[model samples]
Target: MKAVALYGTIGSLVLTALAAVPAGGLTRPDTAGAGTPAPAPPRIAFGRCAPVERLPSSVECGRLTVPLDYAHPRDRQITLTVSRARATGGPKVRQGALVFNPGGPGASSMHFPMYGKTERWRKTARAYDFVGYAPRGVGRSAPLSCQDPAAYAKIPSASPREPSAAFKRQKYAEAKAYAEGCARKAGPALRHFTSANNARDLDMLRAALGEKKLTYMGASYGTYFGAVYATLFPGHVRRMVFDSVVNPDPRQIWYRNNLDQNVAFERRWRDWARWVAKHHKVYRLGTTPQQVLRAYDTVRARLGHRPLAGKVGSAQLQAAFLKTGYNDAYWPVRAAALSAYVKGNPKPLLRQTLPQPGGEAADENSNAVYTAVECNDGPWPRDLRVWDRDNTRVARVAPFETWDNAWLNLPCAFWPRHAPRGASQDPARFATDVTDAALPQAGAAHRPVDVRTAPGALPPVLLLAAERDGATPYPGAVELRRRLAGSSLVTERGAGTHGVSFGTNTCANQYVERYLLTGRTPARDAYCAARAEPKPVLPAK
Candidate 1:
């Protein structure tokens, strides 16, 4: 879940545009991935959240104080904002807390506990107190900020076409500047803003919540967070559901993962293009995928010449179109917008791409924390030449997002967390065989949080994945299934959406709900055919 609005590589685009852990083997430090368990904290004094939170009246919120760096639990502390909606059913039906995290290493999920209010989730709501939290370095939890909103907004967008030497230099300069800004603002604290630490914090939260075993649901990058938690506390996990899973291959952790996303996004783009083409009678964009693509290219190129109403330019065009890859729900509106633009009305496209007023701070904070988590998670290439070469190559085949994603992650090259000594930093090795069962592992310091569990060490994990998922590709679910013993995958075939279970797809949702409600899973892997694509939004003319 690393393709969000504005900034490309952070997480879910739709949520940005619009808008855990384990049971305690308490009183002890984790053997592998966490720090010493903190002392018992006070019960979360639930109260009304701010109006800005948009949480339901039943959803009460509170805060827990936790160690900023788990290694020294006695040192600097930070506040973790927590929210809860208690189980509606009687004691016989209660199953403790069921936590939710909706991707973005930076996405604030203090509002997520309210998701149970929806009809699709009401059954699970009756059985468990839906819990949500803002992880360390996110909203209301010692929020992180790297750049000035004004400065960040002014930062130039990556070129849509093949980059020239001058443009590449500009991008590197921007990346270095962005990196330096983070170092200047957040300083050494940025190192602790990591997935490993996030997992550690979740364990602390679990202990505080008094849960002996953790039951959780995560989407996109949240799956990675869950995987890390399971790796660290396998015995504490009661049940889990990962929707749109992140690939857990040590070799693909941070760098190679983005490269893989480029190819996947291109495929999803084609899927959207084909959908648009089939509706040519209404959209008039094209009658074939290639022609639809040409229409997109034409609009992008024309935007470079003249931004719509002086707001949406080529880069904005790309960002708007990028959401199409994330979910087909955006397809009709997007197709209509593009069609409108081609027909000489830029207002629809303008409405789609313009930034919301006063939302700049949230955007800046999201990008800052995203870079901090990714850069600190593992080693990235230290050299720009390496990035230039790899992104350039990927751009040839997956041009839609390759360079754009490259620019989003460029800051990693200059991040304060340097590659570990003696760790494998070869991006190429992982590129060729990312899904190989027997992958050459990186050093302990550089590898992804070791997620492999001893047989039966963990509970049955249910994976919900869309076949053509763009943000967190489908293969990630497959790899995660292999790593987590007894895990079952319910794949939504031919679907390109990022998150699956919450959508209209009853097939995938059945597996998720059943597993959450009864702790049951398919005997083996299962499949769910995706529903038909959205019909054209514009009326036939």
Candidate 2:
């Protein structure tokens, strides 16, 4: 669930008082003084946004202040940048605010609503104002910086497939250094970058928008965020759609979840290999899955020795192709790149993997925020040995992502060790603390939501995921289905794309469009047989 950005595509409510308690009665009204009404929502004066925010001119932008710590609401504040595109339909036809997050607990989502202008999304745009906001610690919303952009870009790139002991140690040191950098630069704010706070900030955004209830659409990690929102503000939810959902089981809150992603990614990697093999006439990488994999390993090994144009090393090559596991829309370009490279032309491969000068440095913010949020959200293994052992074991079977992902997350092992309440004081103990009750909160610590809400307490949510999605994986949707009793699951069978709704999967998009346009959902789980894999158009000979 970590990335620079995700593209391609890729719930109900309300009842009389006779209905069951909202959010299974788990919600707590914003803490208020006796006989005092909760505070009024902050007024967000909409106006021109800075050009750097990258929003369309027609979309207005504004900022709202929310407490850095809801527990001490008045003590510290942070700015949240929000944007809106008015519903295309008249007010009479408009539903309400439809806020969305484009995954990446760290990715900038200010431009997300712009997708509404596209034909496939025009209908949803007509029905609701397209609302978007940079979640806390992301983009223009009080952005978190842990290292100089230039320094981050220059950090030594290590091959994900390296299995040598020296490589593991090197990665451990780098992760520790990264964690230290965040703590040094971010200070107390680092500990406060929890997902629970993100959910709380979202509720405030809802109030500022003057919406009586929340209508939301989220993909990848956004689904997890939405789940936390529903758990904390069940009464405020009007409707929701969770795409490529993360599994919410306490045991897999995140650390184990990433390991799970490794196996799934390997599966998708094979899927891509098979596709390339099928199109051997075009790519000519191979004629069988095994042959294609050999071609791929050969390219990686060659890059390992002499990086293409001294930029795309084995590390960069793996990173570029990893996108294929997230969405096969990347398969053709990436497949072609490898094929061209194998045929002694490195230009296409380099084009696909090299970062523009000063571009990768900007990714520092995303990387910083991603680590801060994930580490703070729940407990991580305090011991590096635990990680090394687990990742090594998984690497044998799922080599594509195991070590790479291990390095991405190793920072959590050295995160600031002040565990939330109920954790042990020892830093190592805090890291290994697996308190089921304190799993998956948006803030410091909280219990796993009793997602089984009473009738009418929560609307029937819609969940979308490809059967073979590597990022969030398919089982997550099924597990989420079990947790959210009234929810429906739409599976795109045989597909490996992470974001499944708005891409070429017409059958899947039909469900998405229908549920968003009208609050209708299948009574039970649904399935959409996979469409044929995309055919690559060969370039002129």
Candidate 3:
């Protein structure tokens, strides 16, 4: 449920297991053979990082190797590329290393360390070295890929809103073929790229980095990864921040999330449409939100028949405007493009503005990893029949992304993964009690962060959200704060951005800066007003 800078959520989300899990389950035993001398505590071999063009000189890059499967420590190994932008004032300003994840179970976040050099993050930046990595099967970390790259496009689109039976059938075939590609091509990676494994990999890196506990910040899907890490290794967390939180219910981890996003994005798009309507003189396309929506529909319909110079089509337009639901910052530029297209001007429409998933050179790798992680992260109904029913039911009320998102995750229904042994039963006296650290698993695939079963109290962590962010709705953050006892939630009353921490909202970022440097949690949940909305354009010459 993620697009770069945009996103995905769940519906009918309930507050499941909010009780703090009792700490101190026996530390998971090492997997080395009984006779094997504990494999030398894994260490990172640091060196000059590759791909210097996009990276800052101050950041050092290195690789860390971890078991392909944690249970078989001596088996196949995978290397993760890690980068660090070190703190400037040695012991004086140095607090500790801060890890950052930019989300996308597939996004390459190793460069997040560069945020330390930016003026917006610089103050808090001086206190600690910023570290980031491309998780397993992502970027320089043994990236995952599908067998047929073109099958990527075979996945359905949002055109026509309601899907026909043939459309659903084609989606099923493509999704299955795509999943088979991952199974055939990804090998060991297909089995181990789950967030649970990501959490485990982070622990090894923590030990290698010599940090007693992890201080971290994650957005979008990263929030889910962080929650899983917190649940699995609560004792190792020092301070953390979750920005634009992800839905945490194990049952709703992703399938439910795709469905929920349709409703949320429609609401977000409605807000954008009204904003455009409020300044109707500038756009000249609408006097009411409905008119603005019709204007957008006109653009989509025109593109469907004849693309803007054969580049921007209905698919590209929908993909780009998805950002409107993310942040209002994109409103004007995108609105201008729409207006220009309406006036028989195709150049602006053709210009590369938003990163359309289909516009780029075929990228089966990133798409494959995304599906692999999401599908394997939890159970997706394998029954292809369920796809038509749920999506058809959802499209009736929320037609926006119902089909596109359904196809985006459709590959999961056909993902080639068998449940591990004891998938339903606890592995090692694992939670005979539902309130134990094992938490409760719908099965081996449902890996929700189990707070009730997680051991020990978490250090005071901070969570941030926009009251109306469509990408990851605010309720997820509220639920997280309630479930995780020591967390504080900072709200931007109507900021409307997906990841709200380091952007223009000084109020929200301040809490992040304060917490990272001083371990300060707000007295309670707090709120800050949204920045002034951008005014419409002046009369065109």
lDDT winner among the candidates?
1
List the candidate 1 regions with Cα displacement exceeding 4 Å: 1-23, 26-37, 155-158, 418-447, 539-541
Distance from true location, Cα of 532 in model 3, Å:
2.2
lDDT per residue (tens digit) for residues 176-258 in model 2:
78877988898766766766667767778888888878899888888887887776677888889998888876557578788
Question: TM per model?
Answer: 0.90, 0.90, 0.86
The runs of at least 3 residues in candidate 3 whose Cα sits more than 4 Å from the true structure, single-residue gaps closed, are 3-41, 147-158, 353-363, 420-456, 537-541
lDDT of each: 0.76, 0.74, 0.69
Model 2: CA > 4 A from native:
1-5, 8-38, 419-452, 539-541
**Superposition-based RMSD of candidate 1 using all C-alpha atoms, in angstroms:** 6.0
lDDT of 3 by residue, 153-271 (tens): 53223365555678677767767677667777866456677776777777777777778788888888788778877876677788888888877876566677777777788888888
Candidate 2 vs 3: which has more lDDT: 2
Model 2 TM-score? 0.90
Q: In order, what is each prediction's RMSD in angstroms?
A: 6.0, 4.8, 6.3
